[model samples]
Target: MKTKHPYRLGVDLGGTKIETILLDPEGGSLGRERTATPRDPDGPTEYARIRDRVHTLIEAALGKVPHGHACTIGIGIPGTINAQTGRVQNANTTGLIGHPFQQDLETRLGRPIAMENDANCFTLAEARQGAAKGYDLVFGIILGTGCGGGISINGKIHSGRHLIAGEWGHFSVDPEGARCYCGNRGCVETKISGGGVAQSFFERTGQRLTLEEITEGYRQGDPQCRSAFEQFLDDFGRCLGGLISVLDPDAVVLGGGVSNIDELYTLGVEQVRRYAFHERIQTPILKHQLGDSAGVIGAAWIGK
Candidate 1:
């Protein structure tokens, strides 16, 4: 029999795209949709364009459900909601900052909803059903265009007291390193992110190379590429090893484009062992099973 009520709808509000998915009670996808996030040149308010787009996406997702079934909405944003003001804060999408996003979205949808940072959604998904399933403490890391992280304890997100518990990307790895947009020097993101690796290669070789090119060159034994790749591994080891020292998670599941590099599981794991406080690093560092779908699926679970 079909689930009578409390269907789940998830929306991943990413920097460039908005994706929505409908999930049945069994956690199977009923429908999914994706669209470019709307940009408004004439709108007076920044959040208005994106807000309208999200509303449209939600409506479209709901339409895919069986008759008489309505889904509870859960949204994953690139930033966190401020506990004090209930506004979006620390989003790279500047327009979303300071906007009363949750309230505005709730009003437009005419229902209660759940919202969380995208990284948290990724972590939750992994812990609940993806690579980290059955793990008590899971740490999920995203090393894509930028770096970010999230933590899940017993299948539930641990947002922490200040709501920034798993924000490992901004942690300063080098005090004298490059200046970050977050106004910090040598953040973990500035060293291990795909963009960061590319930037580092350019600075050293003065040849602009995409992350794919760098990895390919590394595979082909290019010295400059090898140097960049090794640097990334070192940074990854130190940063992640440091985090493991503190959190000691059951598993560390990696997502994002950079995670595709097989070296992370091999050489990167060795480096982590070297730097980790423990004599023997038994923690398993695994790749994400759900790939890009983790965020959206996790969002649905949040609503559930």
Candidate 2:
């Protein structure tokens, strides 16, 4: 996007961490910082802390700018803002669920702020300059602490009327599968997310294993890990395949820590084809080129 400001500041409010990134017009990172997201049991107090943390980060970024240069501010969160009530909704960070985050932040900073879903920011970053750069219609999927999806066309986000356009993770593919935080059984997140698979493995194996350990055990031929990993991959295929059948995006870019797994492109895509409706699955399931920086950079652009 062509913007008047030479500097852009972006923040990503994730379930585990809150990060801020400063970018030049050329997309070079100027500065960045990350802090653990406050999860105090007191919801209102924690919300205030998160808001102040974001304010602190943005203030630091603004300090780096020259005296006369202006900058745009954008924030990407795990949830979308409810248009009617103007509050956060459907966020994994439960403290942010019903807060007027945007309004509060803008009031604190005394300026306008562009806020969007972190998944949408990821897709927009990918579609513009990451792995899905050349694609016209891109589906950016996050399989991290949770599963989320976003749509980007020509590098612009399509949030739809209710601002939940690409929310396929909540769609229950299994009625009797597992209960989700949203009170639904067998949602896609319950099947493919790192947290989901780990929880499922714990429930079945009576042991706790990190997602990486499970995949490593799968490679090492451990019986329990193999069984759980195989099931996880199957769920990944089924859920992603169903999404592909519906959206049919020109390209699908995988982000989040779980995307680091090599099998999602090979074994996972193969299963996607098996589950997808079309005989010829020409859609490319590509890895993200930007790594963890996509969401923050996307936030910067979305502010324009």
Candidate 3:
């Protein structure tokens, strides 16, 4: 189990929060922490804040590795990342897109650094050490603020010829349905992500509720909440069905807030079966076992 490299660091950057973890070469977590993401309120200010935050988290995580130990750093950013250039492209955050994040961090931290999309990191984590561990082909889906995904094969991400292999959530399921953050209409994401879930809840119940509140209400057996949740499951299943048809992966792992629903895995699997191609071969839909930590851990796995 010995590796050629020493211990490393993983950082998961989100719009609202960032998590940093110290990871041994064998994928064991030594320490971790979470901090709020910097919000600049404007473009330039936000960029400075994010760079500062990234440096802070990396330093904090690196501090845990003792005074003299050397380590590499990997980051899981939630957006379109130019892997070759380490440039981030997304609408939700500014000052980060196309930033020379890896080089700047390397200079500041005195260690090698790598970067990839957050969902891609999630896929790597699951494929290497979590729910999809034994599988050669794994796809990790994130159904959160915006739907996103990552594809890994044999512990490596299949970033496609265009570096966008696992963008399943953005795939247009209904070109004429609802608008998506990616500037598309009827993307599977727009109908099944956290925002989508809240929007659907509001439409169905004539009440405005955040995604957490709605899920909690459903757990508590509120009839309207339950109904709304069921609808979410239906949409999720349809999306999975489509994905299964295309990827036909050994397993499909679900993460993000919605996956935490008590029986969501069971419900989604059953629903996907209705639309899947392999009646003789049932594919499993599993809830991600790594929780939110997957991104950080997976980030440490960049270029592994």
- Lowest lDDT 10-mer window, candidate 1? 38-47
lDDT of 3 by residue, 100-205 (tens): 7666777787666777888999988988888898988888998887788889998898887667789888899887777777788888888888888788677667
CA lDDT scores, all candidates in order: 0.89, 0.90, 0.80
Clashes of 2: 0
Candidate 2 Cα errors over 4 Å, as ranges = 1-6
What's the true lDDT of residue 43 in model 1? 63
On the 0 to 100 scale, the lDDT of residue 89 in model 1 is 92
By TM-score, how accurate is candidate 2?
Answer: 0.93
Candidate 1's residue-wise lDDT over 1-304, tens digit each?
A: 6565578999999988889998886777888989987755446665788988898888888777778766788999999999888999998667788899889978887788999999999999989989899999999999998998999998899998888889999999899998888999999999999988888788888999988899899899999888888888988999999999999999999999998999999999999999999999899999999999999999998883
Ranking, TM-score, top scorer first:
1, 2, 3
Q: Could you tell me how far off, in angstroms, the CA of residue 90 lies in candidate 3 after the best superposition?
A: 2.2
By TM-score, the better pick of 2 and 3 is 2
Off by over 4 Å in 3: 1-3, 63-70, 83-86, 107-111, 211-227
Q: Clashing residue pairs, candidate 2?
A: none
